[model samples]
Target: MAAEPAMQMPSLEELQHWTWVFGQAQQMMLEQGLDMMAHMPGPAAMSHLFEPAAAFRATADFWSDTMTLWSRFLTQEPGAPLGEDAEQARDRRFRAPQWHEQPLFDFLRQSYLVIAEHMLKGVDALEGVDARHKEQLRFATRGFLDAMSPANFPATNPEVLEKIVETKGESLLKGLQHMLNDMARGQLTQTDPDAFEVGRNLATTPGKVVRRTPLYELIQYTPTTPDVLKMPVVIFPPWINRYYILDLTPEKSFIRWAVAQGATVFVVSWKSADASMKDVTWDDYVEGGQIDAIDTVRDLLGVESVHAVGYCVAGTTLAATLAVLAARGQADKVKSATFLTAQVDFSHAGDLSNFVDDEQLALIRSLSSDGYLDGRYMAATFNLLRGRDLIWSYVTNNYLLGKDYAPFELLYWNSDVTNLPAKWHLAYLTDLYRDNRMVEPGALSIGDTPIDLSSVKTPSYIQAGREDHIAPPESVWKLTEHFHGPMRFLLAGSGHIAGVVNPPSSGKYQYWTNGRRVKSLQTFLKGARETKGSWWPDWIAWLRGQDGQTVPAKGERIPGKGKLKSLCDAPGTYVRMR
Candidate 1:
């Protein structure tokens, strides 16, 4: 091997300058170390150090401004606070308070994590690093703390002072973080080579084919025991997310619950998108994806109609599909409709609306110019909106104090990426969020026919979470007003994901409905029947009212039946790239 050129040595002047600077850094560390010790509060007062009282005061000020703005937009009488009158009427309501008017401490726990952040930065700056280098160091340190999943920050070993004031502190933090990364890497390798693989496999697994519909290729849940129902209940999951959120785990899996109910269940797993799918539109999903499923089920099961359940975005799409069918007087195909935390109106939408302005839309459009919206970008936006929980919580725990990452499969699953076809997203954002057009009859055309929500006379059950920030209670309630059909709106006990996945065995989750309108859903459920087991059984009973007794066998389908087969397989290709 060739010898490298000899490096020039530093002059005595440069060496002397660095030596003096290093000494000054050591002096500063000694001073700050003394200051930290002297100012450190006793155990009784220690909690205040991490409380960040100033930050809380700042938060209170911000929310005060926000509440004033939001209060004006409530649909009730101008004087009363939003949702309060509705709550007053509810017999079994929590009187869920809006903390915007309250002190910040009421909303967030005093995070000692903030103390860890302050200590890390203060020590790094005292070490004589340049401002830029110090910032980098700060971030790296924060990431380490975030990974650790520490219980609380000020509570960490006071001994961190001993390590940080010396060169040894830097090495200790770095070494511990490195070990943690190695362990997480190994654990991840066992479960999934990459995050997307977990869902990809679940989606693609072959089983008994319940129905081969044009709108989808579905996976049927095979029960471990004897069969009950002949015609299957086919689920239409929104294309926005992967299908397996329903089959999250053996314990809480909705499919597992359904199988236990002795009903044959099938779920539509959408094909992942690629450049070729850029031209696929909302119409394609309905006409191509959903319409085909109706026909496919008719052929495969010999059943006249199948019970259709749509989740979130899928529920909206399903509602529109029913409208088209109803317009054509073809409502006989779907027995009854069930919506899980789904939205039908954008009126009085939540803060997520702030994310859908022209500039952001343009940025997304530019991205789709390449064929697909990078799912990672979409995920980042949603994650940032809850930064204190999703981003900062992780940052403080993993990067700052050098801790091991927790094995949270749900979080891991959420991080897995999936792509959105450019055409589909563009239409959805413009039509749903921007125009709020879906509520109007014939505002959107499905094929040659006009889609109308009021025309949807299908018996319907809609569920929403009281605490869901994604689709607020008002947003979900918009469905009942628009459908002009027999409707039951249930306000579940938790947030977005929990409301939908709630199993009855988890205890009584309240739902609401009567022949007449109640002041609020929470109030209505108070008077409604209390049931055991999952709500799925209640839904099954509703659908059974509309379904035929005889189970049909497989027959034939249109030419497009095989067109979607090429798109099959798990994580399907669209979810992997991001």
Candidate 2:
């Protein structure tokens, strides 16, 4: 048979040109449609014909306020100061120092603000649309406005113009190369490629992989203290990211810190899912992944019970495992539980819930029909959620200004994403995201047992990031009500990764604790006492209180020395898969 010719990939410039052309076509079509609409009765007039008078009045009032703001801004004297809130607004697009100094830039910025406000109000005023559709429309409109901002274009952006003159066009050339590199990779570059090496500068903490499965590896970190707690600690980090995030550097490693605090720490390093693992599902993860890890920990330590910690999605999985165990009459195997930025209740999963509609899920399923959700696609979704900071800022800095990204460890880990098996991804979206079934009694089942969070009687220490969007603080706080035993919830001062990876030595962020359980998140925040420093110390103290008495440390041994045999070294073969 004759060989089929290989498909040719488009050049970066060709791709960019096509994208520009398509965008221009869409813009023209939209403008023409709006122009046609203008010839007919206007939206306000049409609303009066079909909608309630009160709705029309509200729309008119919004436009009136918008016009008043615009009039004040346009008629203001040249060089007059902006309002305090506008000056202090955290929107980075308008943060160019020149915007405040240059009257033209200031006008453009304020004009964009007014337009965005009106666009959102217009979306809200659409009468026939449901609340969910209205929200999606508003979100889409905001994204469009953000993308069309003058700050993203060299001709309109004062900062880019300044850079062009300063660098004599060299900046633009360098930026083009950076953009091309990102294009080839099919995503935006989040950090400098030359910043850190996996086995050297990052994920360098010493440990040994004591057990291995097709899905994951159990890394038993060497104990640092002369003596350790009688009970061991095992951590289940989310599989979406490499396990090294918990052991990024000796200075900031949560694993290292826990080991140093006289606890035998173990972590699960999930293998990057590929075509070979297409059949892997939530049942496989709970039974084959986490349950196996727990059994291995018990066998290795020769202990009846161990302290378990879960982060993010892994936390969700761990909670389910505990419930499953309780159902099986084996709940005593786990001494206590610690959940970090993990949510069992997906009812209020923050802005991420906005992207979980039926259409989006269908699209994702179609894309991943080959049996895995590509890691790059997942990263892009997350980047889009925080587009201004994660996408456009990089476009402006790396492409417009032609500067290399700074060496950031967290970003490096974030960029190293792992693919998710198709079955597991679909199940997660359907059961947890679409249905919010994890917290509902008997709605979720792993194997033959139905999972229920309320049945898990383990005392839990739950920590939530105040700014977490993936798992909102309120959603995480809801766990206090589900667990049957004592619970302590701590609110940290940063977003997801920052909140979880904070080290006491950094002394950069703070945490809050009311030292009492409260059902309402707002009430908890109102009564919580703010404490400056990492939440690690407070967590370690809490863990110590829950853990058993100290005993002389055992000498380190390879996996083969124990019942669970060896697979590879600490950071593990699975973590290094991709």
Question: Evaluated with lDDT, which candidate comes out highest?
Answer: 2
lDDT of 1: 0.58
Alpha-carbon RMSD to native, per candidate? 16.1, 9.4
Per-residue lDDT, model 2, residue 226, is: 80
Q: Compared with the true structure, what per-residue lDDT tens digits does model 2 show for residues 1-578?
A: 99876535446565456445433543453343323322323223433222466445644654564445344444555433332255337677777787765645665565455445545555565676556555655566666666766688887789889889888999999999999998898878878878887878888877778877789888887777788988888899998889888888779888888887888888889989888888999988899988888888887778888899999999999899999999999998898889999988887787777788777788888878778888887888887777778888888889988887898888888899899998888789888987998888998799899998889889788999989978989899878878888888899999898998999999979999997666788989899999998999998788888865877776443234566566666677787776
Q: In model 2, where do residues sit more than 4 Å from their true spots?
A: 1-88, 126-130, 556-561
Instruction: Let me know the TM-score candidate 1 reaches against the reference structure.
Output: 0.64
Query: What tens-digit string does per-residue lDDT give for candidate 1 at 1-578?
Result: 99866645446575456445433543453345335433433223222332355435534543453344233322211333322234223412112232222222111111222233344634343333444334433443444444332222322323233335544567357645654763674221112224434543333333344333333455655444343466567788877667777776556567777766656566776765668788888888887887677666656555677778888888888988999889888898887788988887986566566566577688899888767787767667666555446665444345444444565545665565567888888788889977899988778888889988888888888887777877888788888878877777766666777767776666645544444566565556567655433566666666566553532222112111322222343323333433
Worst 10-residue stretch by lDDT in candidate 2? 34-43
